[model samples]
Target: MQLPIDFQPGWAPADIEDASAHRFLFLQGALVVLRDGDGARLPDAAYRDLPIGVLHSVGVLDGRACHMAELSDAELPEGLEAVPLRQLFNRLPEALLAVAGRAQQLLDFARSHRFCGACGHANELFDEGRARRCPACGQVAYPRLAPAMMALIKRDGPNGRELLLAHGARFPGVIYSALAGFVEPSESVEDCLHREVFEEVGLRVKNLRYFGSQCWPFPHSLMIAFVADWASGEIVADPAEILDAAWFHIDALPPLPHQITIARRLINATIAEVAPDHPALSVYGAG
Candidate 1:
């Protein structure tokens, strides 16, 4: 999906050596450091003196060079606090949030692929692109991404068009969101969506329509979302995957996902299409 920030991705180290460049500093555990002020922002020249272990170029943002730096220790230089990247959802602009996610994923990739799996040799950054090279075995490793599918099912109910939302077994609190699962080997995204829908809720769906995608950095995942119509089958929430599953009318809905997520966008867009004058539209600030 399109974000509101102006960014052009690049990986050359020489392009981001300027002291005034935007730097996304992260601790050992992928915690981002933000300047303490009116609103959180990525530290710039003020933190250029921190002991950085590694630095990776993350292209350009708003016509300025951007980079992601990994701090060797948790020591802060004062006026800065470390926070999880996910916690900056609404606090930072959408463009900045998206870029931060990219920075985190790139850092995670570099940290995890420090050694070659094939020869157990130390790996070095490849000069040509975003990859690690094993000089001993000629093995090259690139950043890995896991693709997942999110499906929002809808059908005409006695009251109106209702949506099928589920509280996943792993979900925190009582938040109910669209059903989602990862794509398995040798399976397409569409196949994964259909299989996940039936496996989680024991229901059939049809007329799949692509919604959009987001680069989720809970580790590294590309979430592809879609909307579908329920064809048949009764609600039988799988005890293994779903804590609860049901169809809710537009007016009466449970707590939804955060607005930054593609799941929320999918639900909002579908609701606006099905019920243009829905009061929920104004409540959600539907675009």
Candidate 2:
């Protein structure tokens, strides 16, 4: 459960944060603590007093809100569960956690949806409640996920093996990600993947292997990732989205993201570079 570079593992003890759309355990009051990236300890006292909400799940422990598993593997350290947040998503039987996670996502959406686009009336949660509504403009607002793409480009390795990968143009140094982009209007997921690959790397692909999916809440995103083979063309990094593109030996890969994301898990596993798993759910608050 190693978290990506920009991940922060934060949980609102059931008592500390209120779980909307129905109460969730993550919101219950408990002494939760975290040892962030800087190796600093974040005590429960630091956040216990904030207004009951889900924003605590955001990246505050460090530069980014990483998954809790990024912190440790041991469960119940000194009476606190030292675990990763993924376990919540992967382990929990229901979308209760996902609901909370989504609530955290929508919690954010609601903040931004407060303003009215047409009549300029403040929005309120109503419609039995459909979610949110504007008092003046009669505009109903709801949580949304921006459709995005995730693809793996294929090429022939020096040894005759296939090399596939996706790269984002805005990555750090020497870092390329899986091919992904926002699914445009009137286009299928596969269509967007094809167009994005061509537009970004100038390569067409086939046999799009559907791996899995994850609901990314960075301002709301639904990440649909796939594993595709080389259809035709050469490597060309689309300046609009792809910073640079290349093929790896499939065995020797570059820096990859954490298992919390489908984008990372898909490509890494495709190349058999599966990242290690860490513990889920960590408790750091005091007695």
For each candidate in the order shown, give its overall lDDT on alpha carbons: 0.84, 0.53
Q: Candidate 2, which ten residues in sequence have the lowest lDDT sum?
A: 278-287
lDDT of 1 by residue, 117-144 (tens): 9989999889565899999999999999
Model 1 residue 158 lDDT score: 78
List model 2 lDDT by residue over 34-140, tens digit each: 44543223234333333333322333223422221121222333423323334343343233334435544644565567777677777776644335787776777
Q: Each model's TM-score, in the order given?
A: 0.93, 0.62
Q: What is the lDDT of residue 197 in candidate 2?
A: 81
Pairs in steric clash, model 1:
none
Candidate 1 error regions (>4 Å): 1-5, 14-17, 35-38
